[model samples]
Target: MKTIGYQEVREKLLAGEEIAIVDLREEHIFAQNHPLFASNISLSRLEIEIYNRIPRLDTPIVIYDDGDGRVERAYTKLREYCYSNIAVLDGGVAAWQRDGGELFIDVNSASKAFGEFVEHHKGTPSLSAEELKAKIDAQENIVILDARRFDEYQTMSIPTGMSVPGAELVLRAPSLIKDENTQIIVNCAGRTRSIIGTQSLINANLPHEIFALRNGTIGWTLAGQPLEHGQQRSFSDLDTQIDEQVKQNAAQLAKRAGVKQINFIDLQNLQAQQDKTTYIFDVRTEQEYEAGHLPASRWVAGGQLVQETDHYAAVRGARIVLVDDQLVRAYMTGSWLAQMNWNVYVLADDFAQVLVETGGWKPATPQIDVDLFISPDELQQLSTTQNIVIWDFTTAANYKKGHIPHAQWVLKADVSKLIQQPAFTSLDAIVVTCGSSLLAQYAVPEIKTQLKSGQKVYILKGGNAAWAQAGLPLSQELELLSEEIDRYKRPYEGTDISKKAMQAYLDWEFGLVNQLKNDGTHGFFVI
Candidate 1:
């Protein structure tokens, strides 16, 4: 087995070498502590996600954990999947800490930290929640833009705030504003999206005075300011087209950030490169993307691609080609991504004939074994007649909302461990299921290894959805066989979180600028 020291990993990062530092812990656990550039790829999820994330199987890779033996198992699994050139970190994250390496907390730490760093270097201006509220009360001429997704804007937003999203701001702002007197304010649930968005307009030198709503909705909540729920106002795209001047400005900004402009022919050539992993993303809004898009391009809105870079591009040094019809979005997004030191490019092939494909974005869902599945009728009959256990590998939220009456929500990694317990012994059968049974199907071979002599494992055909569609009853009952570690309970999300936790989250974000300095390997450039 090969091992990499922390110093070597740091050196690779420093020299801008191609490498992927994959943390093997579960997402919530990975959020607790990890190296800046490390992407979370849980041991159980590696098989399902590896093909799409790190496309090049031979890319230099180092897997690590918090002093756990999981890395050895993961290494073996990667080899079985034909992923060569793999190594484990010496002593895991413990060794990194001993060598004075910074371990950041929370998901998307690098992006969030980079946002803070951008504000510091660019001197981006902002106004507090109270100040903005006072202006609204005084009947001032202002347009508040929620730079997050439309779904997030619908949750809770500033009064009269419109959903402009992140990359769509500059494209749609011209139509929303009547004159140069109207002030523009950008905001999100927290600070990063709003900060990045606010700066986007500023960087383009748009005539309006742009400012970020300090602290966004989180700050709005803390100040005892009321947040509007279910507001549907947004940037209207009808009768509106981006002006030529705006396009020129956006292109210049991207060029300043060292972004390259590539044509369709160039893209095809890059795809032919066997050694490089290329992530082609269409940085457009959902409605526009569903109407039409380029082939082999995934629809990740520009803002989210920047906000959650790790989730989209796990291979740190991979080439990212962004596509958009309106040059503003692709260039603006390419500008920020390039500043983040990504090998970023904007599609220059005018999009006239390239957008022949249509439909929403689809993931490369892994193929599953059809022979291992049993129909809903079979599962219902088996549940009533035999001693059987049904384990669900779906998300915690989905399980809580509604699930099969006797199904227990459990993590895939814990499924094998649970069957060894006294209560599960001598079961007649074991059934595994997820949303559509695809994920559950991925677990069959491993579950077979843990089954007792005569015990069989089956996937519930079409999973929970099929059961519901057949007029079968579903329950909201809690049947927990594993800890709920799938998704982090975001302090800034939903209405039930304690104020203390929200304040703590904000405090952590405030210090990310300093953490970026401590990490010392983020090759970020702010222009």
Candidate 2:
């Protein structure tokens, strides 16, 4: 009742049973090493994030902490919330590794590892960065499709690349292509999206010659090629209809991957299952998702959902229903997710599921008590008092960048231990602040328990962003309450990385197939 053996959890994962492996630690530390399927849902954000993550309270959930004593607190919190099927990982992560389980050294390990496995088993064709550069130099008849999210494409992309994202290729590429002679090159910031996007088109049986830009933009740079910044060449159109043949090809691929097609009644029946966690997702482009979509479905771009499954859906074995009005796009994404060991479905458009909420993706967020909120101006009024201790829950980088005057950086989970320290115990009041105060509010109730009877706790309204926006002076001095492990810096993202790190990222990806083979728990296959 208290703990589950790693082998049992492994068996559930391998068997594709309903299970969630939660790493209750700061993300940066989690990125260092953890089980391949373990998704980091830190104790600080557990209450706020769990609603959409592990939707079914009775779903089998395993928690682990690396000798940090964090798991006990997490267990108590889950129990307080009436989570029924939760258990700690017996002996924590060490026992898993000791028992021949491999701890992957990055976020989204399962997804990335599966991408490598797909490339290895399917022999997904690709062109090297140098090869792509040569083709571009000669002005060859090719269309470069940046298969990353639209914002990522705008950040930096291959020269002359247009954003097509994931399933959009099967949906819109045909309408855009004028002739059969045109070649298609798909690229992401790194390997996974590019490989997956290229393979999706290949699986759809597109007539055009297709290849993933080897190693993507990172490789493009490593090959001494220039990348274009602030590019907005996107071709996704809401008006474009998927051709009947194209739809059939995509559906065939989905069928081969064992993806189920569901109608409205079927979806309702699946959702009504009290024992199962069902995730309804609009896996279309943001534009289409905004213009119109099935109500009650969460919006995540198809490519991003596939690439960052851990971040989106923490419950690995839950049923995932992907919807797209264009139907073909859902089939394309659902096929890949099905192969990734998810019980995935492509929903039919016949439901009277109206486009009720018509705007950008709105995430379900933490409930904030307005009574505990105090404006930045009030914080300024109280700043002169040495009686107040301001603890910031923002990232260390952001804390370093700028924070409230005299605010000390504290990891949310460390608040209990921190308040015991001499400096914090004597404080008259504690003000919790973060970038948006959303994280801060989550800690307010928890922090209140640790406060002395006369002591008070409050959240800075709008947090650090509001303080800066209000033209208040910010202190750049770094006062530490705990070690900063809030975020893991990805090697492939951002423009500030060195060539060495980019190459290292590519090297890590190149070896993932071998790692996946050694791990053997991932039940992934390519159609």
Instruction: Report, for every candidate in turn, its global Cα lDDT versus the true structure.
Output: 0.87, 0.84
Instruction: Please give the RMSD to the true structure for each candidate, in Å.
Output: 1.7, 2.5
Model 1 per-residue lDDT at 521: 94
Stretches of model 1 off by over 4 angstroms after superposition: 236-239, 350-352, 365-370
Report the lDDT tens digits of candidate 1 across residue range 1-527. 79999999899888877789999888889989899999998876766777777878898999987666678778887887778999888888878989989999999999999899899899889999999999889979899989998888898989989999899988888788758899999999888999999999999888998999998899988999999999889775345667788889999999999999999999999999988888999998777888889888888999999999998888888899999888799999999999999999888886878888889876664455447678888899999999998989888899999999989998877756777787766898888888888677777877787777888888898999998888888999999988888777777778777778888999999999889888899999899
Q: Which window of ten consecutive residues has the lowest lDDT sum in model 1?
A: 361-370
Q: Which candidate ranks first by TM-score, i.e. highest?
A: 1
- As a whole number from 0 to 100, the lDDT of residue 399 in candidate 2 is 94
Q: After superposition, how far is residue 479 of candidate 1 from its true place, in Å?
A: 0.9
> For each predicted model, how many residue pairs clash, with residues at least 3 apart or on different chains?
0, 0
TM-score of 2: 0.92
- TM-score for all models, in order of appearance: 0.96, 0.92
